[model samples]
Target: MKQMLAWQDISRQGAHQGIARMHKAHRDLLDTIELAGRVRSEHPQISCRDIHYAARGQMPRGRDWTEQLLLSCGFRVKTPPRSFTVAGQGVCANLIEGMSITGANQLWQTDITYVWAGRRWYYVSFVVDVYTRRILASHCSRDLSSASQIRCLSGALSRVAGQDLSGLIVHTDRGIQYTSGEYKRYLESHGLRHSMARYAWQNAYCERVNRTIKEGYLQHYTTDSYSSLAAGVCRAVRLYNHSKPHRGLPCRLSPDQFVKELNQGLHPDYRVNIWSKLTSTKMLYVN
Candidate 1:
């Protein structure tokens, strides 16, 4: 009986010592976990990999370790909702497919998304520069009209006024606002080529911008009123352009930072060919 009591005491001491070591290890991780939490709070929809990249200066652990730590700390990562696209007739050809995109202003993509605010739905039109993945302009309205689209496009054009836009191609899905006579006339007057996607996937870049704005930034802001929604949209655009790190960009620089570096000749211009399965299949058959 004495020997049994001694064994039980030893087992209890071992368990306590193991728990103490675990507690100390967790205590040491408090600062890193807090920093990660702050990053996640600021960008609610950011992935764990991005969080680690953003906070790499302060984090001592690697990417996989950071992700595991976040999970163990009870940080629930939310997956974005799935999107579906439908085929449609297009008024213009897909000019960007398989085309080599080398720099900004060469190709711009636009799209519209609905945002719920003030107990109603508000439509927002966004124009993004494909090469830099930067949102150049956006306009919010109560209805999906060509007027809003024109205003949005006008804003984008005004930003680069006096620059040569004759070679610029504006891509969009086959939506009524983009196909309207007024919109087409505006594009012609501005000397911008009209490129329409027959399938929604053809305009993948702009579609991603829509999701980033709606899911990453706007969803976390107050939008109970029209004014709030407009303000939120503005704030989201600024954050996305100035701070959000783009994985596609060199060094994962933000859009604004990439533009700055490019202007300074710090980075070389690279060609990005538009991806299309049909184009690949056709090439294979020809070969």
Candidate 2:
């Protein structure tokens, strides 16, 4: 017998005239997920996973059912895949795995993944602060271009314009935008160094951020346009940066909280740093 708990309880009742094959258990969960999302928006520190565990009384194994239901509703879900093919032929060092990141913006990683908006897929590029696990910048576009990449870089630079970026490193998998002449010039002009993962596995951190947003956040909401998805991305990043605690960090503090402590000259506090704002984005496509 497949013990879904409710079924087991029903059988234990001993007197059931008839049973409906489908129950509204999953349907009823929508309300819980919505409540969780609302709390996440306002509080940002309340973990959605914890909400699910409390709602379902146990963690459900497999994809988030809410996400699965949304996907079933006609959204083209995109997952970051292993890129076995070679990237733009370029020489760059690997900065994440073996390197020690002491603070925010010392090392930043960027990656572009697709998000479904309205009817078509839009490219979403994110620049993450490696030390704090904070999303410093994100932008979406109809086409994969250096412009999007530049915008992400620009956002990061704008935040730290007067500070020395000589020690900072921007890492990414070798892609056209990354390897393009213009992109290289921009990095050189800004005095920012470039780093590349030798293999797909080397890009794990950035990819994890991509998965976190697409699977953990995007899947929970139904977005119809690039603007909607972008706004959703903002909401999701805000929650993650302000709430989610990283195991690697000291005190298990959220990125924002950690960063705030560090910037106050609290040495050995093992904190993080920075505040970020997403740029306005609007674009739509239909399949």
Candidate 3:
């Protein structure tokens, strides 16, 4: 009878310890969930992988675990809206087709996207370097005038004021704003070559940027007014150029980091061959 009593006490103690461990585990899971929520709140449009990377030190879990945690917490990615392209007349040839973009300023892509703010629509023009994947300049306006494109190009040119831009190619779609005489003259004056894409896919680099900025950051922002929208775009550009990690870039670095490393001669052999179906042989390489 004494031996039976001792066994019962030992089992009770073991059960209590098991219950304590379960409670502790529950507390730890709650803490991780809270941390993930905080990270999601900060970067509302980033992917689960990005959030997992962001919460590296705070959550000691792997990528798959973090993804599952986010999914369980109802933190899902929103589907992007459908985009359409307009056909227009262009005067220049596609100079970047099958070209290898090995350095910055060798090729730059520009595009304009529409943003609905307040009771009306606003336009945003962006000039992005194909090599670095950096948005060099952006202009937000109430109208889709050629002046906006000119201003955006001016801003980008100002960044490389002392550099020689003789053979630099500025590619864009067949939009009227781009083919306008004013915009063409501006490019000529700066000694920049003009390249036009017949289809939206041809300008994939800038098109991707347009979608990323609009859907990834701007859509998540509270832009009730034009001023608010502009500010939001500015903040989004800053974050994208500085904070966001690009998978295409070396080491999954941000645009600024990749440019910095490139300037420091870290990635000497890295090259990005522009994907072109126009060429007889497809040459799409990124290393």
Question: TM-scores for all candidates?
Answer: 0.84, 0.65, 0.83
Top model number, lDDT:
3
For all candidates, the clash counts are 0, 4, 0
Lowest lDDT sum, 10 consecutive residues, model 1, at 278-287
- Tens-place lDDT digits, model 3, residues 154-254: 99989888876668999999998988899999988878899999877788889989988998888889998989998999999998898777878887778
lDDT of 1 by residue, 9-126 (tens): 7666667798898987786478668878888766778777777777767876677888788778877567567565443343888898888888889999999998999899998889
Candidate 1: global Cα-lDDT?
Answer: 0.83
Q: In model 1, where do residues sit more than 4 Å from their true spots?
A: 1-28, 83-90, 278-287
In model 3, how large is the Cα lDDT of residue 226?
87
lDDT of candidates 1 onward, in order: 0.83, 0.68, 0.84
Over the full model, what C-alpha lDDT does candidate 3 score relative to the true structure? 0.84
Could you report the Cα RMSD, in angstroms, for every candidate shown?
5.3, 12.0, 4.7
